[model samples]
Target chain A: MPSPRYTRDIPARYRLDAARCSACGHVALPRRTICSGCRSQDMEPVRLTRRGTVVTSTVIHVPPDEFTTEAPYAMAIIETPEGARLMAQVVDCQAEEVVPGMELSLEFRRIRREGHGGILCYGHKGVPVRRHEA
Target chain B: MRDVAIVGAGMTRFGELWDASLRDLFVEAALAGLGSAGADRVDSIYVGNMAAGQFVGQEHLGPLMADHLGMHGVPAVRIESACASGGAALRMGFLDIASGQSDLVLVAGVEKMTDGADVTNVLATASDQETEVYHGITFPGLYAMIARLRMERGTTTEEDLHWIAVKNHRHGAMNPKAQFRREISVDDVARSTMVAEPLRMLHCSPVSDGAAAVLLAPLDQARRYTDRPVRIAGSGMATSTIALADRPDPADLDVVRLSAERAYAMAGMSPERVQLAEVHDCFTVAEVCCLEALHLANGSEASQAARTGYSALGGRVPVNTSGGLKSKGHPVGATGVAQVIELFDQLRGEAGERQVPDAHVGLAQNMGGSGASSVVHILERV
Candidate 1:
């Protein structure tokens, strides 16, 4: 991964910022040139709500090189209230227990280190909101 | 536009292949295709490789393969659409002939995945680096999410997923060149190690290294190469947002539906007209999902279709007779061309043990990066 390209995506990953199509109210996370809902190019930045629900979840036993140490972790496609879905790891819970419809709160966390000499990458992970209350 | 036909098809045995380098595997398959066609040379070549740079530290495969295959000066190019590289290359080759641009074109797909690199990280290059991959998800984890969603909907059962593996392995056992050429039981699949929840090791395709090749020519001139040529009746391709989240539904696989619709329309045929199919079953769930999208199955309840033997060898529509990617060994870039080879064998009455009876029309659907890209080709006996 090139440093400049990696650096450019920092804000989107770190803060869950998205591009909302002005014409159609379609929110595209991490930004987009075309709106998926209406195919409009006019867009503006919008910060996503931290709250969401896991529509589906999986326990990753085999992971990428940087995430090898975190094998067997739970990952999910959590959809926010704004209708934007994103892939994130579900933290602080058993992998099997993470299920559809589970509430989540996105939090910033370390994702990985590129390679031996690469920079450390960080992104948002879904922490089950219900788990804390229980 | 002129009609195009595949005059010859060939592939290497699907496996780890410790002895063959990337270039060697490609040349071997290309030579076999040329030999099968009984032609001394081709006018041009297209090489399909997902990541030669990442997998083998070699890029510019088009010239490398063209040079290795002794076709030094002709137009050669590389095409990539992640896992769909092979199919996408074939699509371009089809267009090359259909548009009267080039008559003799050889398309080859190859991937050398066992090069001691981190397989998971290398495969992750296909995913959305800014959103999905950035959050630390592998292909298995991604597909597993698709499977988990289906399981929750009551449309698919765990048993349905297991049967796909069992069925493909049985088909693979009869194939001499398959990677895992042995049948496995439902219990075996159930007891296998879990890579992701609801998806065991058996449910997944192996990290394989192999190559497959196909030769294309104008349909009118196909007789010059072989008496039994497989006609490229139709071709369709579509792309979705790279981020899986951008799609309407993660479970729908809309791009697959769109591509299949286009191919079927271009062929002027319906799903019922297809006697056999070679689907991109990189995972068990993908087979069922794609079946629904292709309209081979009446509904999204593909679990019912699998359980009732709708996709069996002797059923309404035989699928994955080549053992699919699960058993056939998906070399990433080689899968599309390999699929066309299976269609060629079946249509020519050459597929011995796992042949679909009286097969005339066949469809091959190859997809890339979790439905980010999909290519569909419909073939028939010419």
Candidate 2:
């Protein structure tokens, strides 16, 4: 089989970082090389808030190759404290526990392991930041 | 530029076509399209395919498809833009006609996904291999992340996403060309096995084997082929960064927006003016995000509208009337042109029970690889 392509750096060790347009107030996540809205190259590297909230999510039973072992994992589109919106896996929760507006925090975890003898990959995953964690 | 119109459209039943070969599927669709157009000869051929080399260990699909269709020695070109390959091929064929380069052209897309290969790995090839896939993100995982972010932004809801799958599947049940031709309820979608978090088995399109083709020619020439011709009023295509994380907002698909903007501008219409649409619903969340990007509904209002049947066949501005990629079956390369075929049938009033009454104007939005590429086309009755 052909090697898999890791297209996005977000959620991975790269954990999408970006800067917003100060003039237009458009948030730029994953560190835009050039703002598509304002074309502003004058950007800053801003770390995204570790904490976020689940705005929407899905449970994928049928997964692609490297992710086969992790079927039925909760994936969500989360918004961070800095108003940064990204897609990440929701960890430390059952599939049914994922819901809209659920607060979460970012963490580095194993995303997928390659072929039988291949390498195991790591990335940023989102876990619910709840009051019961005490 | 001359006005290009779709004179003929053809599509095979989409599903696990184990008995069919890639070339066989392409030829079947191409021959049907040619027969419908009553054309004895094709001036040129264009094929849209995502990863034939990876999926079937076959490359050079352009000439291969041409030869298989018996249009040997013609100018055969292959178009690739991940999942948008079919739409991209249609654009190329459209240009050929509008430019007066060809009077009769064959635009086709096909993929043998269930060819007994490790399709999962093949599909991963559409992503940014070095960054996203290497980091262990599958397409579903990528979209799941997007759904999560959309939730945080209050852009959409899980129920909204589920409605997309359920509605498309409902429409798909009426489509003989669809792969999974069974109706599914929102509960069925919600209860399906999970592939990635928040995305259930029923929320995603199946890996299918199928083919679709459209015959394009000058509007004046189209009349000689068919009395009820569907005119290609406008087409728009755009690209984004390969990496999902490279995008500014994981929840938003600006490429689809840009393409829709250009297409709508060229067609002199707005989202409300479109009576029907066939969008790439590879995943349920994709449908929600795409609806927002196309301006079919406000991002925040998408979930509610979905629940209310605003995007259903009998509702205002019907969406995925042919079940979309979700139920229609996604053969990757064949996905785009299949959308066009659905639009053609709807515009011609040939869409039987699933048809939207008086669907005069329609649109098709096809995406490639997690929204990295998108192609939008607006068509109307001539």
Candidate 3:
């Protein structure tokens, strides 16, 4: 990935910043000028919640070049209470343990290194929400 | 617009063709198509190639392929829509003839995937780089998520999925041009190494290097080229969200449904009228989804089509009779053109062993990037 492209997505990756369309209330992550739902340009910047529920997931055993070291990791589509969805890696648990309906909190973490001498890329990863023991 | 017909079709045997360069594959397929049509030259050419720049470090394919095929000075262009590039190019050729702009047009799709480039990374470029690919999601990973959702919804089962590979491999055994030309049982598919959960290595289409080409002409002039010409009845293309997660229902594949609806509407036919089809089965789950989306089967019937032999040869609506992307080979851009070749062969009674009896109408559905884009074409034996 190019450095400029990575830098442009920092706000969404780091803070879950999204844009909500005033016309149809559709929230677009990483923001967009035009609305996908209603094609309206009336949009407002909003911060998405850090927590979401897993909509679907897959454990990637054969990964791409950048994520080879993180093989056997779970990546999932997480839906937030705001009705927005984003894809993120589900970490801090076994890959097989991440399932649909599981609750997770997105946390800022180092995603991967572009190459041997490339800069470190950081993004949000899903951490399983644990319950308090009585 | 005037009606268009495919007067000729040809393709290179799909596999790891380390001996063939990108230009060699295109020229070979182009010559075969021209020879089959008995035409000394074409008025224009359209090349369907996904990533020649990334795979072979070459671009400007329009002129490059035209010059190599000895058709320089003719109008030539390349069309791309990820994996659906072939179908998109065919559509362009169809329009060119239908609009009276060209009399004879050649459409070819080629990909040299064995060229030492990182195939996975090159393919990943089709997806949303910042959103999806940045997270390390391979194409298998995307389809695996869809498979999981389908399994959870009872739309398909692991066993049902394996039946697809089994059926395609069985059909591929009869196709001399297929890459994997041997039969396999459901057990064989189940025992294969798992690439992504619910999708084994057998369930995925292999990365391949090959090319396919077709010659198109106005329906009125088609007889001058061939005695038996397959009429291109309808062509439709549609798109959806690039990122799979953006869809309301990832398994629905609305792009396929929309494109098929347009094609069926234009053809003045319904899904039932399609006697045979070559659907994009990049993954086993994809075939299941495409069946339902194309309206060839509904609900669980899509999953059960293979198990009950309904989708196999000699069934109600034989599908993937030329193997499929699963067993035949998916050289990205070449897949759509290859699908047309299969339909053309079957319609003309040229497909020796896996021919669909009395096949009059056929459909080809090609999709790209986890169903983000789709192209549907309906053909009739004219």
Candidate 4:
């Protein structure tokens, strides 16, 4: 990964930082200057909760080049409690077991190595919330 | 605004052509289109290409292609909208003629995807790189997520999705330009390797190398180029959120619906008047969603169209008569231009075996990544 690109997103990747639209109360993950809902520029920075719910998921058998070793992993669109949706890989559970409406706790992790000996990219991964914890 | 017409349409055989370079494909298709229109020169050229730098380590395609085609010194530009690049280029050409800026225009779309680049990674660039690709989500994985949502909603089944592949392959068998001409049964789709869960290999459009081109002129002067010209009655394009997760409803392709609506309104007709169609069926589920969004099928009709043979040739409303992206080959950028070529052939009564009976009106819908961008056009036989 390029250092500039990797370092620029550290706040969001490390802390789940997001921007809330002051006009519409819509939250944008990874932060944005403009709100998609109401097109407001009056945005406030906010950190989203580490927990979210799986809206949809797929078990990828044929992975991309950067993730060849991570084949058969579960990737999904997870909706945070603030209603901001973002994509993440669901781990620490069977790939096939990840389903919609399942509760998940996002954890900071190393997503992938950009290339052989390249910079290691970091992001959030979802772990299923156990029934006992509920 | 003046109306535009497609005076000529041509394309290369869509498949892995190891012999053809990117420039070779573009020039060949452009010359073919020119020949079909009985002309050798165009006032301007629009090249639609995605990821030329990534695929072939080349850029500045507009001047490069114009010079290669022996039409140097003419105004030329490249347009990119991911997979909808071709359609977007066509739209530009149409507007050029409609707005009376240029008399004759050439629109071409080409992609050489089998050039040893990381095809999966190259395609993933169409999605939100920071939010989606960084998490290792492939295009199939994104669509598979939608397929899961549709299945969970009881709107479609795995069998229903497989039937889309079967129907397209059957149609493709009749198209000599198609990559996969052999028809397969639902069992074949079921047995194919799963790229993403619930989406098999057969369900995904293959990475291909091909090019397609079309000649556009004002409708009044169309007869001078060709006696049987297909009028571009309507052209529409719309865009939405780049990431699939950003959609309010993951299962609904609102971009398709919005673009189709704009095209239908411009054409002064409804979906009911369309006798044939070529939609962006990059994935099987995409076709299902498109059918409903285009209003060709309503409610459950979209899911059942393949199983009931309603979307097959000789049926009520035949779709993808040119085999579509599924079997016809999806070279990404070339797909949208090829769809218009299919409509041109069908409207001009040039489509051989897969021709729709008395097909007077046709529609083509091309899309970018995960419904972020969509371009729709309606053609009428004149």
Name the top DockQ candidate: 4
Model 3 agreement with the true structure over A1-134: per-residue lDDT tens digits: 58898788889888889999999999998799998888999999999999999999999988997887888899999998888899899999999999889999999999999777888999989999998837
The candidate with the higher lDDT, 2 or 4, is 4
Could you give candidate 2's per-residue lDDT for residues B246-335 as a string of tens digits? Answer: 576667899999999999998888888899899988988888888888999885666665678888877877889888888889999999
Candidate 4, DockQ score (0 to 1): 0.89
Compose the digit string of candidate 1's lDDT tens values, residues A56-130. 889988777677888879998989998888888999888888999999899888888888988888888888776
Correct interface contacts retained, every candidate: 0.92, 0.53, 0.73, 0.86
Interface RMSD of 3: 0.7
Instruction: Give the poorly placed runs of model 4, Cα more than 4 Å off.
Output: none
In model 3, which regions exceed 4 Å deviation?
A: none
TM-score of chain B of each: 0.99, 0.98, 0.99, 0.99
Supply candidate 4's per-residue lDDT for B198.
Answer: 92
Task: Compare candidates 2 and 3 on DockQ and give the better one.
Answer: 3
Candidate 4's residue-wise lDDT over B335-361, tens digit each? Answer: 999999999999888899998978899
lDDT per residue, candidate 4, A94-131, as tens digits?
A: 99999999999999899999777888888899999998
TM-score of 1: 0.97
Considering the two chains of model 4, state its CAPRI-style docking category: high
- How much native contact recovery, as a fraction, does model 1 achieve? 0.92
lDDT for each residue of candidate 1 in B184-301, tens digit (9 for 90 to 100): 9999999999988888899999999999999999999999999999999999999987877667788889999999999999999988899889999999999999999988886544
Task: Give the better candidate number (1 or 4) by DockQ.
Answer: 4
Q: Of the pair 2 and 4, which is ahead by TM-score?
A: 4
